[model samples]
Target chain A: MQETPRIRMLLGLADDALIHGHRLSEWTGHAPTLEEELALANIALDLIGQARALYQATGLPEDDLAYLRDPHQFRNVLIAELPNGDFAFTIARLLLVATAADLAWRDAATSDDSDLPAIAAMARNEIAYHIRHAADWLIRLGDGTEESHRRSQNALDALWPYTGELTVGIDRSAWLGAIEAVLERATLTHPADGWMQGGGRDGRHTEHLGHLLAEMQILPRSHPGATW
Target chain B: MTNTPLWEVFVRARNGLAHKHVGSVHAADATMALQAARDVYTRRGEGLSLWVVPSNAIVASDPTDREMLFEPTGSKIYRHPTFYEVPEEVGHM
Candidate 1:
């Protein structure tokens, strides 16, 4: 059976939020400080909340959608699944994705579709907080102690390549034009010099995503019908 | 201990009547200081606004100095009501 355009759109939204949320959750007990640990957990919750709304919009049970699918069935772009390397790397990813998601939602808030716009509005508010939290870290790490500064720069460089997939601007279903248009407007007009790195959309992900997915999907994949 | 700087956090929640001291977190600098404060104190939608100030910026008196600092007028009888009568109609005290 064919899925509706709205369903397809909703699935993409849910997939992105779920995968990212899962990735963030891995940092729960591993952060360098108690404060950072809590911050990462809170962001994870925000993404999960976004995923729940998108799943509801698509008429799918959020739990089933998150846990029932095999790896290949997932459509989250590689950036969402890339491993969290270090505190600096995680902060870099947070800044990049939060900025990207904020831009995407800014356009989505004005989507031609009724329900998606409302969902996007709520997501936009949450994204604002995410952006603020990550941006502060970005600035501190970017301009802090010599070691921190080096780590932040390295993190930005490492994560830069995966960010390309975030603004692919194409949807298989033609119904997503509004979202695409919004993305174009929201994407950073001129990313700071030398920050444009590409190649995450065509499924040629970095080695990191494979390992991350293996560990992340194991619990659900091993016991397909199990509930926690 | 001497090398570490202290920070004080003030949070204003959405439903709160005033900005109150929530808790504090330590960081190497002012920017990280504020970020740490947010992460430490506002995990559950507990803050709409936040302020972080270096603890050293505040001036405080030692508790040991309390008597000399505040005892000058303690014995002024006029400062306390020695006796008073409440009318029966004054109601609950």
Candidate 2:
């Protein structure tokens, strides 16, 4: 399909939500504690819900778009597709992505040319909670014991390169301020700026996205007519 | 799971109602505990507001003394307001 800019932007956001939500859902039976499991699952559900809205705005059934997309067709930033390393790594990535998402959705909600203001509006509310949840976890992990602090710092350093790709529908400075404030409170040093990565929006992604898509689309592709 | 403390969660369903003890969550601190409470208890919109406290901080009555304390109050008919014979004009009182 030859998508207009608006529809493309919507699909990109939808991809981000769906892929990141899937990553979070991977923690379903594996989180360290029951409460943490519930928390991650709840946030995952919220992201997937946002994905559904954006997919609908593109005039396609959400399941079809989500379950049938090829790796090259997905437009989620590489950051969202990265493996959840450790608990600290998960929190660090979520803090960055949720902050960026909050900014992106806030801008999309008020844009005069937006076709679905309501989708962005609801997304803003959901991302607000996601930002807080991720920030709190990051702070505790970063400022915590020797092992946790080291892990948090390492995750931030590793994930810093992909933060550049999040500016698709938002300003870097606006979102960076929020991320830096949380880093300051977390007592974690922000990684010095260096080479930045991009191209996901144009369908170029890391090897991780391919593996992720295969795992995500397997059931749907394998059993085309399967139903509950 | 790294020896995180447990917290007791209370949720108020609406304004003008007291927060009722709903459940518990494990968190490293109060903020995480409160956020966890929101995720664990209010996902279905069951709460209007929430409070989370360290589970150890709560001073619960000893269950072993239940027979000596609550059982005494249960049989005290004098504590019953129904003992009073009021005229119909007294209304709810």
Error of 2 at A222 (Å): 1.6
Go through the candidates in order and give each one's DockQ. 0.46, 0.78
* DockQ of candidate 2 relative to the true structure: 0.78
In Å, residue A66's CA in model 1 sits off its true spot by 0.3
How displaced is residue A193 in candidate 1, in Å?
A: 11
Q: After superposition, how far is residue A208 of candidate 1 from its true place, in Å?
A: 4.9
Give per-residue CA lDDT, model 1, range B1-93, as digits (tens): 235577999998866468898767767678777877877887777888988889889899999999998998887778777578788998997
lDDT of 1 by residue, A1-228 (tens): 245766766776677788888889998888777767877888898898999888877766766677665555566777787777888778767766776777677678888975779888788878887777776666666656787777767776676556666666533133123223322433312123355444433334456656666776678788876776
lDDT of 2 at A52: 89
Q: Which window of ten consecutive residues has the lowest lDDT sum in model 2 chain B?
A: B75-84
- Tell me the lDDT of model 1 at A34: 72
The parts of candidate 2 lying over 4 Å away from their true place are B81-93
**Correct interface contacts retained, every candidate:** 0.72, 0.89
Interface RMSD values, listed in order for every candidate: 3.2, 1.0
Model 2 has fnat of 0.89
